[model samples]
Target chain A: MFDQSNHLPALPGVGYKPQHYSDLLADPAPVGWLEIHAENYMGAGGRPIAQLKYLAERFPISVHGVGLSIGGECDLDPDHLARLEHLCDWLNPASFSEHLAWSTHESAFLNDLLPLPYTEATLNRVCAHIDQLQDVIGRRMLLENPSSYLAFDESTYEEPAFLAEVSKRTGCGLLLDVNNIFVSATNLNYDPRAYVDAFPLDKVGEIHLGGHDEDEDDHGAPLLIDSHGREVADPVWTLLDYTLARSGPLPTLIEWDTDVPEWPLLAAEARRAQTALAQLDSKVTA
Target chain B: MSQSAFNAALLNPTANRPNGLSDAGGRPAGKRFDVYRNNVTVSLREALETGFPATARLLGEQNFNTIATGYLRANPPSSPLMMLYGGGFPRYISAIPALAKLAYLRDVARLEYAMRQSYHAEDAPALDPARLASLPPEALNNARLTFAAATQLVLTPWPIHAIRAKALGESGENPPAHAQPTLVTRPEFDPILTPLPADQGDLCGALMAGKTLAEASTLHPAADLGQLLGTLLASQALTDIHVEERT
Candidate 1:
C-alpha cells in the first residue's frame, strides 16, 4: 500500500553529521538527501533535533535505524518502536530503512550488526517484525543487507535471494548496501557481480557506498571487514557503477562513520557518486 | 537450532562463555567465536572512547581502554545503535576498584555524559526576557520557572568544565583547586559548559526540584535574582513559567 516512486531523489547524498552542519547549511551542496541514524534524534529536545530539523527543511531526510533487531526471537521492542514513530512523525523523512541483521538479543545489545541464519523460521519472524514496525510508524520500511564477519552453518539461502524473499513476504522495499555485498562476497569467497545480478533490482529503493578493510582468516583466507572508516576502494566503485548501470538511478548514500574527515572530503566523495551515476546514465542513453 | 539457542549463539556469546562448536571435519569453531566476541568488546570500548572522550583522556587511553573493556564485558550495550547507549558507563567507572584512585574520574565521566545527554536532550524556546522581567518582585520568586529540555546540572566535586575543555585541546589552566558544580545545556545547537556558583547551583537545584522561582530565590537572597533569571533566559535555559499558589 505504501508505494511512492519519488520517495528518494535521483542525486547523490551523504549521512548527516552535526560537525558538518555549518558546511551543509552555509552552502547547500548538490547532494540530494541527508540520512540520519534514527536513534540519534530520539531525544525529546537537543542539538541533534534542532540541526536535523534545520537540515530536513533544506534537503530530503531518511531515517536509517540500526537497533531494531529484526532477526531476534523476541517480539518487537515497543519503546524503541514508539521512539521511531515519534521521530518519523517529526522528521517526515523521504524514506526509512533498517538492517536485515539482529544486533540485540534477549536483553543484551552487542552494539554490532551481527549475522543471522537465513531460514524459513527466521524469515517469518523478520517479516512479522517488519509488519509491526510498519503499523507503528505508519510507513513502509526498507530493510538493508548486513555486512557479515561470519556465515552460520544453519543458513539455507544466499543473501540476495533471502532479501528478495523477505521483500516479497513483507511487502517492503530493500536498501541494498553494495558495500555490504562487496564485504560479504569477499569474506565468503563469492562473486560480487553475480550477487548483484541476483538481487531484486526493481525492489531496491536505495544504495550505500562505503570502505572495507582487509584481514585474514586462520587459514590465511582474505576477510573483508566493513569498517566504513576510509575512502571507497576502486573495486567497490566499479561494482557500484555496474549496479547503477543495470538498476538505473537510485538514491545513494556515502557513509563514512569513523575517522570522519572534514566536510569537503565527504562532499568530494558524494560528488564522485554523482559523476558515476551521471556517467552510467549517459552510457545507458548512448 | 531452536530460536532460543540461535539467540544464545548471537547475543549471549559470553553467557556460557565459550560454547564449543564442531564443524564437519570435527574442528572447533569456538576460537572464531572467541575472536568475534573480543572484536565486539573492543568495538564497544572504542565507542565509549568517542562517547566520553574527556573521561577517557583524563584516565589516559591505555588505562581507559582496559577498564572500559571490563565494564563492557560486565554490562554490554542495551541497544545496538550506540547513540543512546553508554548511559551506565559513568556509574560503572565508579564501581571499578582499580580506578578508584582517580576519585574524580567518575564525576568527570558523569559530567561528560551529561554534556552528551544535554546535547541530544530536546530543543525548547526559552522564556522571553521581557515577559520574565515584567513579573512583580514579589511574584518573581513565587513563579515556577520551567527549564529548557536540554538543560542539565552535574553537581560534581571535580572541576569538570575545565578538565573537559582541556581534553578538547582548549588552552586553559584547570579552575582554582576547588570542587565546582557545572551546568551543561545545548542552548543553541552546541553544548556549553559553565561553572556555577555554589549558591546558584543550590538555587538551580531547587528550581529543578519543581520549586517556584520565588522559593528558589529565597534560598539565596543575595543572588541578584533578576540578573540570574536574565542570564538563564538568555542561555535558553528558562522555558516556561507559572505562578505556584502559595501553600
Candidate 2:
C-alpha cells in the first residue's frame, strides 16, 4: 500500500492522459500532481497501470471515479465495488472522488454522468451507495455535484441542500466542481454565485475546473455543456477564483478529456489554476 | 417515478416519459430527458468507435452509428468500465444480416478487439533466448514454452492484418484476397501485429495448445521451425519454458 499520509498539495494538477505519458515523464514540468479516471486504470496490467506506478511514486495521485454510479437506483454493484477496492488497495491514492450522478440502472451501464431528482428518496439512495462505497474502499471519498440540463419537478430539495445533507449524513467530503456549478446554474437559470455561497465549503476537499460548451436550452436560454474538451473558459477561471476565496485553496484540477491539446497547453491551464491558488496565498499573507 | 421505469425511458428515447417527471417549473420533462438520452447514446457510440476503429471505417460513420444504436439497445454495457464496454460488439456485427455480405467485417472487429486485449494484457519478462539455446538437444523436443500474456493469435479467413493496416492509414493499397493469420504481441509498451504464413500459424496454434517443440514441429512439417522459433524469441513472446521428460 502507498503512503496515505502524503496528501495532494493545495496546488494545481491536470487529468493525466496516456498519450502524454512519455512527455510527462520526460519533462514533468512544475505541475503539482495528477488525476486519472478510476475506470481507465482498472485493467489487470498494462501501460496505464505501469505509468501510474511510475507517476504514483513521484506525485500525489487523485483517483476520480466515473463508473461507480453512486446515485443509481438499485444497490451498488458489488463487482464494481470490488474492482474499486482492489484499485484503491493497490494505488492508495492521496484522494478518491466520484460524481454525485448515477450511470447504471437495470444492468445497463450508461457512460454519462446522469442527473437525479434531489428528493428525500434520492438522498437516502445516494447515502446508502456512498456508505457502501466508503466501506468497501475504506476511505472518505469526495462526491462531486453534477451539471444537468434539466431539473425534475418531483425534486423536493435543492441540489446544494441535497449535497450538504448527503455530506452531513455519510461523513464524506465534497469536490466542488466550479464549472459544473456554472453550467448547471446557467442551464437552470440560477445564480452560480448563490449556489457557491450555499455550498458547504468547509466540507470541500478538492476543486475542479473544466471547459464547457455553449448551447441553447429548450427555452432558448444559454445552456452550458460540461464538455471538458478545451481549455478552461475565462468565466470558469473567475469562478474558480471566487470558489477558492471561500474554500481557501483546495487542491485544484484542470480537466481536459477530449480534444486533448499539447502538453504545454494543458500545463499552462494548470499554471493558471496555480495562479489562482497563489493569489489566494498572497491575499492571506497580506 | 420508479427507478427502473426512469432508467428504461432514459436508455430508450422512444419510451414514454415516466409519471411524475416534470421540470423544475412543473413543465413536462421531455426536453430534459432528450438531453440525457442524447448524452447516453453519444457517449456509448463514441466508446464503440474507439474500441472498433477499423469496423467503424469499413461501415462508414453513418452506417456504423446506426449499427451502434441497435447494438447499444440490444446489448447494453454489462460493466461500468468503458475499456470493457464493447465485449459483444464483434459477435453483434457477425450476427447482423446486412453485414453478411461483408464476411470479413467481423474478423476485422475481432482483430481490433485483440489489439485492445493485448494492449491491456498482463506484463511479464520475456524468457531469455540463451535459455532455449542452452537446452540440451535431446531436451529441446520436449520443451513446452509459455507465452507472454500480451501475446495473442488470431487465425482468420480474412486478411485482417492488411485490412486493419489499410483502414488505419498505414497502407494506401487495398488488402489482398488471401487469408492471413496474425500474431499480436506487446513486447514493450505498444502492441504490434504481424501476419504469419499458414504453416507458421499452425505451428503456433499447436504450441499454444500445449504441444512441445517436437510435437508442434510435426504438426506443421513443412514449416521452417528455426524461423518460427527465431521469430517468437525475437518478438519476446515466450515467457517461460519447461522440459517434459518421457520415460
lDDT of 1 by residue, A90-195 (tens): 7778899999977676677776666677888888898999999999989989999988656666678888899999999889999988998888787666789999
Per-residue lDDT of A9 in model 2: 85
- Over 4 Å off in model 2, which ranges? A1-4, A26-30
**What is the i-RMS of every prediction?**
3.4, 1.7
- How does candidate 1 score on lDDT? 0.78
Which 10 consecutive residues of model 2 chain A have the lowest summed lDDT? A1-10
lDDT of 2 at B179: 81
- Every model: Cα RMSD to truth: 3.5, 2.0
CA error at residue A269 for candidate 1, angstroms: 2.8
Model 1 CAPRI rating: acceptable
> What TM-score does chain B alone reach in each candidate, compared with the true chain B?
0.86, 0.95
Clashing pairs in 1: A45-B121, A45-B122, A45-B123, A46-B122, A46-B123, B141-B213, B141-B214, B142-B214
- lDDT tens readout by residue for model 2, A160-270: 899999999999999999999988887777889999999999999899999998876566667678999988888888888888898897899989998899998988888
Q: Residue-wise lDDT of candidate 1 within B1-247, one digit each (tens)?
A: 4545544554354565333343223344444454456657777888889889988887887888888877777777776557666889888888888877877878888887887777777667777878876878777667887887778888877777777778777847755677677777666877787777666766777888898876677777766666556657767787888876667
